[model samples]
Target: MSLEKIKTVTLADVSINNKGEYGIGASAVDYSDELYTYLRITDINDDGTLNKNDLKSVDDVDAKNYLLNENDVVFARTGNSTGKAYYYDKMDGELVYAGFLIKFSLDSSKINPKFMKYYVLSKDYKGWVNSMCTGSTRPNINAKMYGNMELILPPREQQDFLVNILGEIDNKIEINKMINKNLEKTLITIFNSWFINFENYDNSKGMKIDDSYGEIPVDWSVEMLEDYVDFVTGVEPGSKNYHEKPEPNDIPFLRVGDLGSRDNGVFIDPSLSKNKILKYDDIVLSLDATIGIVKMGLEGAYSTGMRKLVIKNDNINQPFLYCLVKSNRIQRIIETFATGTTILHAGKSIKHMNFVLSDKKTMDDFGKIGNPIISIILTNLKEIEYLTNLRDTLLPKLMSGEIDVSEVNCDLELKYNYMKYLFNQIHTPMSKSVV
Candidate 1:
């Protein structure tokens, strides 16, 4: 039969999203910037981005066979994680899938790679997963099942058209993320130089002196962390109060899993935890399973496993405080506060933590440098949130044919152009600011 005559296709068809292989069953090692990232089911979020919180890597002599390329998609094959899918983007760098994941090489000529990934994440696909994964002891689907799954095919040109539209939005989001990552690295570099190494001290102001933590500029004094900041403990509010689709009064209730920009995961009714409300620029740290992941740039209510550091005033530079918690020194100390082998808890013990109170002038100097870098990171995060919301709103509509590809009047183009404008406005100044 002629391909043009077909209105539906199985994913297993080699000319489509095929070339299936089960992932390498190797155990994960620590994540290294230099090594290929290990993509496990746990490493993918529901919306199909890498879970940045606990990403690990693998180093093996047979690594070449496991390496993934662009146009590849992976499926989470077992347990409750079934039906989750992630497609490799060149932006994500090199990755190798772990066991419990299934990989497919997507052929763009037959199907849009991004489209296929989105399809698997669709309500239709989820309904299918719910139905197919039932009656089994646990939800499990193999490569053969994935191959047999069907797609109501659209013409190649239409698929391309849809991919072009949606892909641009995702591409912009990724570019912003990459920009933010570079900006953060810049913050760390300056932080290490000015604070840790004392490399940038103007000798006219002060000289290095021995402190409990190696050497610091003469005028700096160490103080209890509680003096400059107050740690606000979050409440459980219970799983019954959780809301994935937040109503008007519901705020994102953060968990350890949400260390990624303090994100769009579970929301909670704010009335349940009114006093625990968090806002932008608030610093939150995870103390349980993951340990010592500090992040800002979110608005929500936090869970008990996390702590929101309340700044008393400008005495502790906010950006300085942020980088401080992320520092290896503070991080090590924070880990010691935890008491469990399986799930650690820093909890109320944060009160016992000591803080290095840099001299006022140095903090001000560092803040001037660090603030903009952090501001850029925070701004990029906000923009990412916005772009994600836009894509999410459009996705189901687009996938279900509610919004046609010939959407000449689609506001997505207008909004997308604005996103690009924001991107262009951001990159140059941020790059120049880092030095």
Candidate 2:
């Protein structure tokens, strides 16, 4: 925890260069196996992680010049995303960063790149960024300003210890995220087959009928969403009432922003928050600003920009309703209803939207299968929240040296040796195959 031996140096002293190389100009080409991965500012999440699925590709011509390497850090230097950074690792593959981003390659002998990444998340770094970005219409941090920023560098050993512990926590969170993503993809495929395409239905038993919307099975019918589900807009407690840190009994205040972000939104005092409490499988739709974007409930009070969909009738399954609202068809319908040129709203139009509905028995059948998947997804989300909180809790303490993690390396070594011993004891080899 001692700062007596620490060195204070400008970013340029520890990095390979003061300014990052500009990325390739123009839009990314279509995704092709032959093309290199093209990384943009939008592809990097607020948490500094890359969204692999949303990435595009660029032609190989001069693309190698922009290719990122392990330990390289890319910073968003322009627009609303000024000062945002993304650290490249071995797993990110061959990727080229965009022009708006400035890459800072650290001198490993002087400072650990991973540790520098975490430092950027610290209050001091954020404060420095804010100070440099004052009173500008378009906020931008040029390469020279970035390189001139001062940083407090600890000894190599201390930096390694902090990075190892934080990296382990990050790896676990990413694992859970991947699991939830796969589960969602699987659930949607099942829903599409049974409900949308009617792939599993027996045509011999199903009779075709004509309706105003389209042809449908005689057993199926169409209904306005409001007929079976109650839609309630979220509340907006002024910023004064919001709590920066969560209270013991307070619930998280969900906003349209927190829909898919890793970090949960700010917490609100339960006593003061008048918004309807969301539950598992409840549908949440972004009705203001970013219209038509939908999310499933994670048990929080939503913000004014969102609407919570609650099932008023037992015949409609909650999971089905969630999928229905999240579908492209519903999104399109909601978009058509959206009003306003600058800030769109969908509350009025969404109320009267109609969708083809299956019979109660069919819904029940889908629920039997989809509910378990939804339950697992919700469980994963809860785990992610717990891990995220744990990491957040550890971050400041570790950064400030309030907690001495000097012994963490020793503890990890002992734990790993014990695990290896257990594996050797339990995993004995069979002399012959039973088959």
Best by lDDT: 2
Error of 2 at 66 (Å): 1.5
Residue-level lDDT tens digits of model 2 in 31-106: 7878888889878876777877567898767888888987788888889888788888778788888888888888
In terms of TM-score, how similar is model 2 to the real structure?
A: 0.84
Steric collisions counted per model: 0, 0
Local accuracy of candidate 1 as per-residue lDDT tens digits, 1-435: 234533677778733435578988788899898777888888887778777767898988776689888778888899977888888876677888988998888787667777786776567788888888889888899989988888776666555555776678778788988898888888888888877887777667666555566666677766778888888878888988787776676666777767743233777776888588667778888877777888777677777888898889988788888888888878877877778887777764576677667767778988888888888888887777666655555666555554454535556677466444544554321110100
Please give the CA lDDT of all the candidate structures.
0.74, 0.74
Clash pairs, model 2 backbone = none
Worst 10 residues of 2 by lDDT: 426-435
Q: How many Å off is the CA of 119 in candidate 1?
A: 1.9
Q: Alpha-carbon error at 222 in model 1, in Å?
A: 1.3
